[model samples]
Target: MAIISLEYYSEVLGMNREVKVIYPEQNKVENFTGKEIPVLYLLHGMSGNENSWINRSGIDRLIRKTNLAIVMPSTDLGFYINTTYGMNYFDAIALELPKVIHNFFPNLSTKREKNFIAGLSMGGYGAFRLALGTNTFSYAASLSGVLTFNGMEEHFDDNPAYWGGLFGTMENFKGSENEILPLAARFEGERPKLYAWCGKQDLLYSGNEYVANELKKMNYDLTYETADGIHEWYYWTRKIETVFEWLPINYIKEERAF
Candidate 1:
């Protein structure tokens, strides 16, 4: 596997951004040749950059056997939304980033079924938002995601300016494009398969449960799981392996020496 740290200028964001890419080495795996590899657009939690998944979760080692390419982008605290403050982060992730990746690595497949997205905490919200809001990814996973804003006032109340910048006041948030629940309900056409995992003891558990129930009512292809865990790297690092297992991809067998 080849791990590359890519730095490039983004036309959508109007700035340079860094993305960590994990690509499979074709010759290292058995029976892999001349085929486009599936890609996973992995996202990080709040305050995490492109290096979070690799540095925190040991993702590089986990997917060493799989013939998959992973693209991890840094979005600061943008929540992967278009943002009320004029940053079109949603467009960046949903549209521009893919084009950028494909241009750089033409071997990565662009088909809906070959594309996937997943994230943790705020990024968990981002994964669903992107999947439901657009028809790009065929699958998505959320780990300890903040699926709803039901009782999150206390967390945002501490920093009104920060919250307002992202959503432009909580009053207009519910039915807006930034909201995930409404998107899930109102989405039309083909829906991406969804997977969500939240620890029972985590603060976001109730929200995850609520959203999972709502998806069930809507008959979304969703798989929700829970266990004893808290909102931290330890839980995410462990659960991400399960996320990989849940993805609908054929794992490449590692070549063994005789």
Candidate 2:
């Protein structure tokens, strides 16, 4: 596999942003096909930049066997939302970034089925919000994601005014544009197949459970799992592997041995 870190000017964000991309390389023993490749738009959380997954996890080595293309983008503390403060992060990820990616990597498929999104913490919320609001992705997964109650003061202790800047105010958070629960419910067309996993002891566990139960009630296609873990890389690393298993990856057996 080839890992590339690059930067480009984003029209939506009106700034240069960095992204890390992983593309599969050809196996010495087999011919490489020119067919479109499955793409995963992986997102990073709060303080994490584009390199979070590559630096903190074994993501580079995990999918070496498969012909999947991974795109990791940085949104800083924007929570992947177009903040009330005028940051156009939502448009950047949900709409423009895909076009940027497609232009940069023609081998990546633009089809709904071949495109997926996943993230951890803040990114987890972003993944679900983007998929549900735009109805663009075929599937989305969240690892210890913050799916509801964006106004929770405990999570944003460092910046008490955080949610206010993102959603206008704590009172407006529920059923607002930045909230995922209302977005998921309002989606009229086909919804993305969702997968969510969180450690039972994690602070956000109850919220994840609430989301799972609601999704089940809505008859949405959701896969929810729980285990003994906390909000850390140890838990996230294991969940990522689980995500790959759930995704429809066309693995190249011969290339895996390398």
Candidate 3:
């Protein structure tokens, strides 16, 4: 596998951004014919950047034998939303990022069936938001995501500037496009298959359950799971492989030298 740190200017974000891409080595694939490869748009949590997943999840080692490309983008603390402070991170990820990726690597497939999204914590929310808000990804997964903000006031109440810049205020978040439940409800196109996993002891467990139940009521194809874990990288690193396994793609296995 080839791990590339690509830095480029994002016209959407109006600034230079860096993305980490994990691409399958073409020379390693048996009978290689330069076919289009499936892609997983992996996102990071609130306190992470593009390098979070690759550095912490052991994803590079786990998927070394699979013919899949992973794109990891940094969105700061925007929570993958079109922030009230005028940053269009949601558009950057949902729309511009793919075009950027495809422009750079033409072999990465653009079809919905070949595209997937997943993340941990804040990024888990981003995965659902991007998938439900747009028809780009065929599958979406979340690991201990903050699916709802119904009771998260205490977490941000003291930091008004931080919270205000992201959403204006907690009151403004409800029923807004930033909230996942409303996005799922208002979405009118094909629904992406959804997978959500949160630890039984996680602080966000109730929020995940609430959102999962609501999505079930809305007739969404969602898979929700819970086990002994927490909101840490150890839990995410183990579950990310499961997310890949849950995706509807056949892995092209290649023999490794090591």
Candidate 4:
């Protein structure tokens, strides 16, 4: 596998941002039938940047056998939302990043069926949000994601400025813009196949259950999993392998004229 660090100015964010991409290497004897490769928009947790998955979960090693390219973009503490106080992280993720990625890596497919997203903690919410809100990804997974903003606010409401800045007032967050359930419900027509996995011992376990059950109840194609674990890199690392198995990835094989 090959890893590339990308630094470019994003008009959406109005600043230069960094992105990490992992491209699977092909054999010298084997060649791709087409230029495009399947892509996964991998996201990071609140405290992590673009290197979170590569450094913590060793994601490159996990997907080394697959024909998938992983696009990891840093959103800082924006919660993957267009903040009331600052830049449009949501547009950066759901929109601009793809254009920049496609412009750079034309071999990466832009098709919805070939596209996917997954993230942990805050990124978990982002994966779902981007997938549902934009209809760009056919599949999405959340690992120990903050699915319920209200529940999180209830427990960690001490920092009003922190949450308020990203989501605006509490009433605003209740709308379809920030909440997962509302976003999923308001989305018309076909929805992305959703997968959610949370450790039973995780603090956000119930929130995952809440959103997962709501998706299931809405007749959504959702795969929900839970086990004896906690919210940590260890669990995310293990669960991510399962996510790879669940993804609808297509490998190209063709005879090349040498």
Best by TM-score: 1
Question: What tens digits encode model 3's per-residue C-alpha lDDT throughout 1-258?
Answer: 899999999888899999999998867655445567889999999889999987786788888767789999989999998998889999999999999999999999999999999999999999999998899999999999989988888756889898889888778887988889998999987889999999988999999999999999999999999998878898898788788788876554333333
lDDT values, one for every candidate: 0.89, 0.86, 0.88, 0.86
Residue-level lDDT tens digits of model 4 in 1-258:
789999999998889999999987876213544467889999999889999999987777676667889999999999898888877999998999999999999999999889999999999999998988888999999999999865566533677788788887677778756788888889976789999999999999888888888899999999999998998998998788888889986433332221
- RMSD in Å for model 4: 4.7
- Candidate 4 wrongly placed segments (more than 4 Å): 28-31, 250-258
Q: Name the regions of candidate 2 deviating beyond 4 angstroms.
A: 28-32, 150-160, 251-258
Q: State candidate 1's TM-score.
A: 0.95
TM-score of each: 0.95, 0.93, 0.94, 0.93
Clashing pairs in 3: none
Which rank order by TM-score, best down to worst? Answer: 1, 3, 4, 2
Candidate 4 TM-score to native: 0.93
* lDDT, candidate 1, 1-258, per-residue tens: 889999999899899999999998767656676367889999999989999999887787777768889999988999999877889999999999999999999989999999999999999999999999999999999999989998887656788788888987778787887788789889988899999999999999999999999899999999999999999999898777777788887664333221
lDDT (tens digit, per residue) of candidate 2 on 1-258: 899886899999899998899988777213557478889999998889899999998788877768788999988989888888899898998899889988888888999999999999999998898888786899999999999873365544556577568776566666876777777778888779999999999989999999899998988899999999999988897788889889887544332222
